[model samples]
Target: MTADSEISEQPIEPATDVRPVDSEVVLARGHLHPAILLLRLLDAMRQSVVTVVAGLALGLPWLLAIAAGMFLLQLGYALARYLTLEYRLTATELRVREGLLHRQERRIPLDRIQDLGFESTILRRALGLTVVLVETASGSGVEARLDALSRSHADHLREVLLEARREIVAAQQAEDDAITGPGTADASAADNSTATASTAADEPEWLVHRSTSKELFLRGLTDLRLSAFVVTGFALFEMADYLGFLTQMSGVARGVRDWFAQFDPVVLGLLLLVLLLVVISFGVITGTVGNLVQFHGFQLTLRGSVLHRRFGLLTTRQKTLPRDRIQRVTIEQPWLRRATGYGVVKADSAGGSRAQGEDTAGGWDVVVPLTRLENAFALLPALLPGLEREHLPWQRGSRRLVMRTTIVGVLIGLAGAAALWSTAGSLALLALLTIPIWALLGILAFRNLAYALGDRFLALQHGIVGRYIAYLPTAKIQSVVVRQSPVEQLLGLAELTVHVAGGSPTRLPDLTIENALELRGELARIAAIAAARDWQTRANATATRPPADRVGESQLDPAAPPAGDRRPWTEPRGDGPAADEDHDRPGGAPPDSSRPL
Candidate 1:
């Protein structure tokens, strides 16, 4: 063991150093809770169960020895980690140090932290421990994890970290105002005063949303997908095969099939229908139960600029996200949910993996899991200030888009009929019956597709059977592009795509070429302005910091447009809109102007 580990494992001693009143000081310092050792060992055992069982069954002494050796190594590593890992909270940053041979340390600035999340499984909960996850704007997943900290310590650490981050941000904002002149000082002062008053009063967080049992059940019911049941059935079969029960299960299935064959054809059809119903019912019940376990006691609250979310039954989770980090808010309405007047609200921030499947499993990114459609829209302003769904001046695409879509659908119908002609002969004529349905779908798609450019947000709404409305902050937009396929070019139609951090690009398809070009230029200009403002803010903040801690200008604003590239939007590309074209044209007119929120 290293000297650091030796000292850390010993009992705590009183500090002897005297520090100045205004100097940086350590707020908290400690190793993970002792329960982590047992937790790690349990995890190791769980993972090795299959190997151990196989070894014993096969009477392979060497395999058993290998498993035993691996278990011991894991146990030793866990013990070393428990003894050496130390986390320290300083005034400006959180420092974590570990390792005995290759000593390493990680220092994360409090202001850069995006969220602090806590999770506890049944075992950890039983031990009064929780896992702390630290996230940052690194475009990665969790940046740091402190597994199995005492619940009280974890909660206390969260409060301290958030308070420190707020103070740092306020200080930076004040410094920026000082550097930029007196124009923003009054607003800064007012914000500071509000924060101070809230802190002084120890005000309780304002409850934003809560999920009841009925709501959770409805959420699960509306969220049902046939794909999930199909996947589950396949997983069950795989597990049965792994456990050496596949042969017996197959024999039982064959016997049931034989019995069903003995019944009348009409009765067999009815029996099959009943079986399908039973399967559907079982899927619904399982889905509801899973939802209940995942989202029980769900609640969301706002404390100043931070949003707090708490939920779950068997594995509870508590997460905090700052409002400023959010890049976009998406409101989703599946066909069933739309029919039931329900919708889901999700928010993507500046960092973390963009895995929607994982998000659903862990309830990540979801601001409001399930709520009434109107209520879901109502919650938008809470996340992004000044956003009002009813006030948006939504713009629809050209009518030609509908016609183009209908043509494509009809073509597809013809193709399908041609492919089936040889196999089904005259019966293939039934494929033409789908043409009307496709045309109706195209019309619905046209009606649902719309885009709105507000002062601070760019909103896009689209979908046919299911609907999605995405509100992306103009300041967070990273890139804008206009794309046209050969068919679209022939039809004078184009697609505009806007990219943002930590999420997939949002596309506004089936737009007229003129409108697409105009929108792309406007969005690009907005992104450049946002980047310039961010650079100024960062420069001011850097000026206030000590020279030794300062970063380069390029590092301060990596998103800034290249020098002399500011007017790329105004420049003409080959075969695209001309730079000298009149802006007053119907489709080329700029969007309505609105004051910044």
Candidate 2:
């Protein structure tokens, strides 16, 4: 941060004109309990049991009887393990405090935590476990869980987190004041605010920000990522298959069975058909089922001006991820999602949890996960007053890619199908099946191709879903790219990749050359104006091109002066030339390394 920016940071204070404040308490929290680990292992093992039972359900009567016996044995072991497991909680941090004889304790301080997300699957809810995730950027993080704890205990832990944070903040402010001459009340308030874990709880109630359900849903829908969706879907399908629904499904597919039986075909042929059907079934079931359960029963509630959500089926999960954590926010519309008027929304939070985070850490950085479609823009003003959704700069070209790819793919598939038909009669069906596959691929390629959402925060709305919103404060971003690969060049397009902190990148593809270039220039100019770090400004101002004879940094902008004589990346100069090459390192054209967003 620049000296001016630092100076500009005024002392912050909340007016005391309103109502009396609630009592601040120093609550004690327990260490991570051991029962939590046992519970997790139990859940995992339960999944295995479910697999066996499902398999047995599809087997012959005698096999089913055997499976029942095996299930009983396994269940007995699980019950024993659960009863023997040991876990406890403490006031300052969770003390895993497990094991019958030899024990281990992992301590995670609440003060260092950046996130306190909660999780409860349908079964976990029934079992009464609100999986507590104590998240931090530092590798020293903890999952302080209290499985099957009564509601009172869960509430108590949350209260303890607040207390710990308040204590830490108050202590920090006291220390800083001693060193900095006790600047302003506002500054103290700001310090205290951040120290409290969330802006909502720390700052005065009126000063807190809130986002509605519509806004929350939009955020969730926009962050949807195709890779995540694909992976999650596949995993769900595999699990479902392990449940042996397919075998039962096959039994009901009597027409198919009868058709094969009549043909007197080789057993291999019957197996191949069933396999193909299973794969298709997996995809369809996974995609549809995953979406339904995740997006179901989603609701956004605001308390004391803080936007929070309560979601999940069997076990309800509630979260109050602060808006300030969001560095960038985006909304997206895939063809299918768009057709349904659903727009997914996401935000980038530096050093925060991931949306829908895994159970172990940073439960979910995302504020809204799998929100409904119709309202992406309704919630922007909560953080950014004027931000609005903008269409992808290169959306139209998706149609072209979709049509062309579909045709080519179909042709290749037809050719392959023809070749295989003579060797294996079932292969002839490929000609018919390939069309849907190619078309779907085309849809994905097309739908996933375009991207948009750039404003003050540098938002990029990409991905199909499970969506991702990689947020970074503009100041945290290192650089922005507008480059054209040969493919893009041929297609008169360029891809815009926004560089961010933590190496999480966001890409906007198939943008028109003109649009991409405009964005590049606009961002470059913004980089200069918005930079609060003096050193960064100076480096950018004096950045020099590489030498004419070299491909290094020296040749980048020869028109400028030597880089050695130039100031750092953020120093502003009133009289310096547009750029100075005097300080150039004769060889390197490396730009000032902006902190990766």
The per-residue C-alpha lDDT of model 1 at residue 255 equals 70
The prediction achieving the highest TM-score against the true structure is: 1
Compose the digit string of candidate 2's lDDT tens values, residues 531-580: 43323222211121000110121121222322211212233212212133
Report the Cα lDDT for candidate 2: 0.45
**Any idea how many clashes model 2 has?**
83
Q: Cα lDDT of all candidates, in order?
A: 0.67, 0.45
C-alpha root-mean-square deviation, candidate 2:
15.6
Cα deviation of 422 in candidate 1 (Å)? 4.8
List the RMSD of every prediction in angstroms: 13.0, 15.6
Q: Give the candidate number with the greatest lDDT.
A: 1
